[model samples]
Target: MSATPAPNASQSDAFAQLLRGSLLPTAVVGLGCVVVGLFSSPKAAWSAAVGAVIVLFFFSLTLLVMKRTADLAPTTTMMVVMATYTVKVLVLGVAMFALRDVSWASGYAIGVSITVCAVVWLFFEMRAYKRLRIFAYDPDGAASLETPAPKHDAAPTDREPRDEP
Candidate 1:
């Protein structure tokens, strides 16, 4: 079977808008971590920066996958989402284990920065979704009440009445 088409421009635009909304909070969290880490050590600052980058990378990847799969069937979209999440989590776990013992890496700084930035990103993303008016569900099948119904008087019938015998 032929593959499904990609999402339209508007869907892509909405994803982009979400990314934009998340950016400022993510950056602020990253910068705050870096500044906090600075007082500890250069390595701590670097670790926080690495954590920020990792979070940003994963978040962007998730959004990219979501955008790419938006036009597909719901099941296909769900599969993609699960697959991406699985891979992202596995990779992050491996990276954390590998970097756990590195002398220059500050685990505490990385952990704290990642945690805070992730929470911030999630909050902003939720807010963006709440503010967006992309979809509305109407269970009753009533036409949207936003627009006024057209005015139409009953039309006269084009037939004459028969006389009774």
Candidate 2:
């Protein structure tokens, strides 16, 4: 009944790996959006860059919190992630709303592009999480948790009594 030790991040491509791997893709996506923005509207490109920064900041914060509190309850973890996501979206939405009178089409495009990049990053992270499944426990008492029950070849207790004439 012994449990295997969790894999080390160093031994596997994990959270850090995903973040590192995403850098090039993120930059490529951002550059493409900027180029598109310049052609579509330079103002939109600038707005998209700002939106991307906000989104990345919020996403990184969520990851940091999750990494720190991996042992916490699932509800608590989801709440933190959801709360941060809501804040980020709200802030971005408010910014776009405030600039509604301006070239909103570009702004919206930029915002959506940044969001797409964030979603891409999230997909990689989720993949890594599925593979990692990191967990923490008291190493000392860990053995106790895995202790097996004593084995016995005892007969069934509920067996009916044999009748003798």
Candidate 3:
């Protein structure tokens, strides 16, 4: 069978920008955790992988929500975010209860791995978000978010009158 390559995504896209910033660091930590776990025991290795997968999947969902709401009003976006979080929390609680007795994925290893992945992911995601262009002044906006301001003296007429006689 012949192998065909998948379509390429642009790095300039919002989703891609956040994905690169967050996924790289999370994946690195996950890989390291899994590698360390492998040396400890087979069960540890699988647990680490499982834990990492759970956190990564949840994070990806958050990013997807952001992308979908990028053009929405700030209030709307926050509402969507809160809704998504509530759903995830409910799902996680049920999943945790279901996995309470599972021995294949040790609780300790899973907890440690999940904790590390989550912290690393949050740190990287914060960094990435800070780097995103969000110019609030210009009508065109985000296009100039990272662009340097034009060098020019402010026009006197640009200022509004403070008082009238």
Candidate 4:
């Protein structure tokens, strides 16, 4: 069979962004925790990975919800993200606490990795937002419906009033 064609520049860029956004941070924290534990307490290192797996599972579920509900209001999306993060942190904390005698450095490593992932995700999101805003602001672009600004009062301003006062 013929060799497959290499991916285009944009595709490669997207893949790179995905790797930075999703994988690197998680791997960082996971590997860090495991290594730290390997020296201090091998058992805890293994246990921390299992715990991180559960947290990652929850993260995947949260991302799915966000993707499926993108058309929802900003407030709604914020609520979902916050709720998911809170739940994940609580569960992870409890699990780690349960293994109190274990080395705590593993937990630190896991936290660092997740933080790295979050930073990557935030960076990509900001980039996407910038692109969308730039496209929407293009002068030659097609006209589109504008969301009306909220009114502070119900007074009618359709016609000018007489200056009889």
Best by lDDT: 1
The Cα error of candidate 1 at residue 81, in Å, is: 1.0
Best-fitting candidate, scored by TM-score: 1
TM-score of each: 0.76, 0.58, 0.68, 0.49
What order do candidates take by lDDT, descending? Answer: 1, 3, 2, 4
For residues 1-165, write the lDDT of model 4, one tens digit per residue: 897755444444443454345554565666665676577576656655665565556655655666544557889978887887788778656755655454544554454434444454446545644544434374864454566789989876888878996
Q: How far in Å is the alpha carbon of 146 misplaced in model 3?
A: 23
- In TM-score terms, candidate 1 sits at 0.76
Candidate 1 local lDDT, 33-100, one digit each (tens): 99999999999999999988888899888999999898899999999999998998787667666776
Residue-by-residue lDDT tens digits, candidate 2, 11-119:
3335466566555566677667777777767787876676666656666666666565555788987887788778877876776566555644465765576677777
> Tens digit of lDDT per residue, candidate 3, span 112-140?
77878888998998898788765457776
Provide the overall lDDT of each model, using Cα atoms, as 2-decimal numbers: 0.85, 0.66, 0.79, 0.58
